[model samples]
Target: MKQDEMIKLGISIGDLNGIGSEIVLKTFDDSRMLDFCTPIIFANTKILNFLKKQYKLSLHFQGIDHPSNAIDGKVNVVNVWKENVNINFGEEDTKIGEYAFRSLEAATAALKKDEIDVLVTAPINKATIQSDKFKFPGHTDYLARELGGESLMFMITDNLKVGLLTDHVALKDIASVITPDLIEKKIRTIQETLKKDFRIRKPKIAVLGINPHSGDNGLIGKEDEEVLKPTIKKLRDKGDLVFGPYAADSFFGTKNYKNFDAVIASYHDQGLVPFKTLSFGRGVNFTAGLSKVRTSPDHGTAFEIAGKNEANLNSFKEAVFKGIEIYKAREEYKELTENPLKKQGKKI
Candidate 1:
């Protein structure tokens, strides 16, 4: 296959002290994955080679100076940095954290320039990744700034899809942040993501309440009645298929989420807790509403089992597949919109 014909998958090696490298190697160890996309890992080949020996894997990486030099059907590595970085698995070293940021920075620059097609990022240690150059809570915030979009943390699996209204925010600040404007923006972002990225023509979305029992008619709190209820009602009045402010306590316990295309949660824990519970090993965290497609494993850097050769590669592999799918879906959506007459003829 030609390089242009293959989807160029740019990967950022997350915290080296974590399971990022392990999962990346295990996923691509299958030669069949090369048939789908040409992966360019943004890290030094020497370091990866060291890990290759430690894990005793049989994958070979072709080193390249730039992503454009990537060869199809080959695992490629961009030398984002030179020299050796000591790798002590299960330990958080600030030096390793800097190298993690370096890998991500290079890959994101390639994404912005269209040097690569889609990006599947490995998990990063949120606390360790904090520095003067990288001050965001996580990848989503940094990507939002660099890629230019109102991003939504959309956690997805085959059977369930959840979007967070407020992600990476403190528990106490969630209520104040759940304003009418914030709720509306997030819901619209989810709707656009469903339509363009997921190919849902008319998506039905459900919103979980802020307070228990949707504020118990203003007894528990007035945010649900004053903020959520009005905002969701406004969106519905405009012919959007959005429902809820459903009582959070029973929304998922009753399987009410099955009725909608996606569920929008009021806060991080409210959405992710149920999401991770239902689909721990299978979920993909997709950053929706961005110009470029990006995804990551829903789970984090499991320091406990970093180099034990016991990390499950399912979520990381799923993330790679999901990124490619969304990239193709977006391209198809763009093509159909460019020729409205062709799109109209298909319906007839």
Candidate 2:
């Protein structure tokens, strides 16, 4: 794909009652965004119209039956459902969960069929989205299973990239699930993603410690000393530029994260707190290490502010751009790898 080529962006309309439709409507409000990529929103046309009318917005999009009919210079919506579903703002129910999953399933089907080039998922209720058909911790886990690869919850921006070994696990169980092997696997995925997806030839990664002060040299805990340090050493010995069981407290405070290309958090909060704090408004939650490109806004379904038309579209907009950027980068990366010896022109 060329730099200015139109990438098909598949968007699963998250919980309709939340800000998913709002942000989606707002993002495509400007037709200039259409120049960059054609957005195929997997959502109910009627639901989107309701939001548009409620806000008195002019974000008109064409409703189509399939992504095959997506048109450039227009916002396209593929209907996943037809019935007029009532939206009770600031509410959670099983019906809402089912509705959200319908969009996600349709979008992923398109992704698998290559109908869409990249995906920008809207926020869904984690608790609600857990049905028999969709049984996983979150998007990363669900996509990992569906796509047949390990997924890393990578927070990405121009300055910092953070990947999580243990995603959506309770804090208490994070230690049990995040072993050295798990760390190495996820880190390896991040390394490869940085190289291929982001075009970082040699990426430096930082691993934050689970314990305080990396277990204070085993004073506070031993997991850092016993598990994390040894893991870093073995990975480094294998020629990966990975560093540290750095203490979570000072890792971002001292601007240490600036020294690396990416950081791996032991658990969700240890990484997300600093990440959201720094990149919340414009950051992207990129599901790295997958065969496909998937990015979402850093925040969740803002039920409180859903219908108020007050949602910030920066993060969601960034998610859309990030998806396109990664797609282009991966394509270019594949070209380079496919013709590796071409770099030297068969030099003697």
Candidate 3:
């Protein structure tokens, strides 16, 4: 893929009632977005028109019947739904959930067919989307099943990059899944993803301990000492720059996360709480180990402030930009890997 051949990006419009539509509209309004890649929004034209009227945002939607008909330097939207369904901003509705899932399915199909270079998804309501027709925990699990890869969720920001070992699982169940093999698998996934996707050479990973002070010599918990420590040692021996079973509480505050390329969190909130607190609106959620590139905003569907025109579009914009960055980086890394001697003569 040459730089002149514009990368085709597919945007899955998440829950219509949520901030997904708003952010998508806002992101396209910026002309600079076209400079990097051509965007195709998989959404209903009626819903987008409604948002335009409600928010009074400056955006023009060019609906295309086919992907080949998509125009450059314009917001090309593939209208999935024709009817203008009732949308209650901030209210949870099964209809919106269905629409969101449909959009995702369409985007996923396009990615698999190589119609799109990258996929940027907006926020979706997990609870409402779990009905009879559409049943999945969230995008991570759904995407994993669709793409056929070991999926790992990683939060990326300017300061911290953290991956979850067990995501969207209960706190009690986390320990049961925290085995040496699972930990090692997640670490290796992160390592390979950083090198291949993000183009980080010799990535250093920090694994977080499940217990406080890493079990304090087994006084607090045995899993940290028994399971996590051994996993870290095994990875180190395998020539991976992996360290710790580190204390989760003190690690974030001491700026230790900056020292590593990525951190592996034991569970959800153990890493997300700190990550969101620090990089909430600016953070980008990237799904690693997938066959295709998928990135989304860190925040969820903010139902309370949905249609009030008060939702922030910064995170979605970052998600789109980060997707482009990673895609370009992956291409560059592939070039270097294919011809290492070519890189030898290049400037350092």
Candidate 4:
């Protein structure tokens, strides 16, 4: 990938019954999208048409047989399904789920074959997609499995960025899985991604503790003192700017999150509660440590306002923009790595 070359993006249409089609249609309406990268959406044309008619959008979608038939200034949609089916918005159907899964699988296959530069997925319903054929947790797990299952969930906002040590797990089971090795692995993965994908030369990561008041020095729980502290010390001794065992509650309250480049939460809610509060409809979910770039909007399917056309495309728009940014950044990093003198004494 060259800096001057155009990046091609393979987009997977999320749940068709949800607001996925709406956001995809709305996002392509913006003319500025053409300036960033060439987008190829893997979805049913019938569903896209339904949303366009429902929303009364003026944008036109050009259905193509393959990625090579795509044209500029027009939304290129590849029909992954052979048959055109009726889509009922705000209602869940197994056929729609299967179609969504197929679209994602097609996009993933294209991505694996180097046909596209990055993948920007729309949201999908987890339960609906967990049938006999597609038995994965969500996009993160599904993509991880497809891409050799080596990845971590990295959620981002302009103000705060949090990476989970354990995601998509039950609350009670989280404590048992919060081992020192797992914490170290997640931290290292995030650190590497910050450098490679984000173009941060030296990323400073802040690790959140597992207990209240950071275990109050073993008063509340020993996990903080016994597990988290040693891991942070180890990472620091390795010349990594990793600190904490910081109490999760006060860490975000005192605006302490602003000090570091990224935050590592011990469990799911410990990080997402504050993260969602600050960036519910504005954040971008990035899967770090994949061979190829992958990103999605932070928000999920807004079933309540599904057909009302009140869904906000801001997060989806940001996800696309961030995907482009990461792809470009990764290209630059690769270039810099190839030619170290190009970045010498240059302000990063």
Q: Which candidate has the top score in lDDT?
A: 1
* TM-score for each candidate, following the candidate numbering: 0.98, 0.96, 0.96, 0.95
Q: What is the lDDT of residue 91 in candidate 4?
A: 84
- Per-residue accuracy of model 4 over 1-348 as CA lDDT, tens digit each: 765656788899988888988898898888778888888999867767877999889878789988777776678899898687667778878777888889899999988888888899998988777677688778988888788635899999767789999998987887788888998889889988889887777999999988888899999978888888998998899899999989888999899999999999988788888998988889999999888889999988777778788999999888998898898888888888988888786654
By summed lDDT, which 10 consecutive residues of candidate 2 come out lowest?
339-348
Task: Residues 24-70, candidate 3: write the lDDT tens digits.
Answer: 88888888889888999998777788788898877888898766677
Q: Pick the candidate with the highest TM-score.
A: 1
Candidate 1's TM-score reads: 0.98
Off by over 4 Å in 2: 1-5, 341-348
- Rank by lDDT, highest first: 1, 2, 3, 4
The CA lDDT at 99 in model 4 is 82
Q: Model 1 segments beyond 4 Å from truth?
A: 1-4, 345-348
Report the candidate with higher TM-score, 2 versus 4. 2
Could you tell me the lDDT of residue 283 within candidate 4? Answer: 93
Better of 1 and 3 by lDDT: 1
lDDT by candidate, in order shown: 0.93, 0.89, 0.88, 0.86
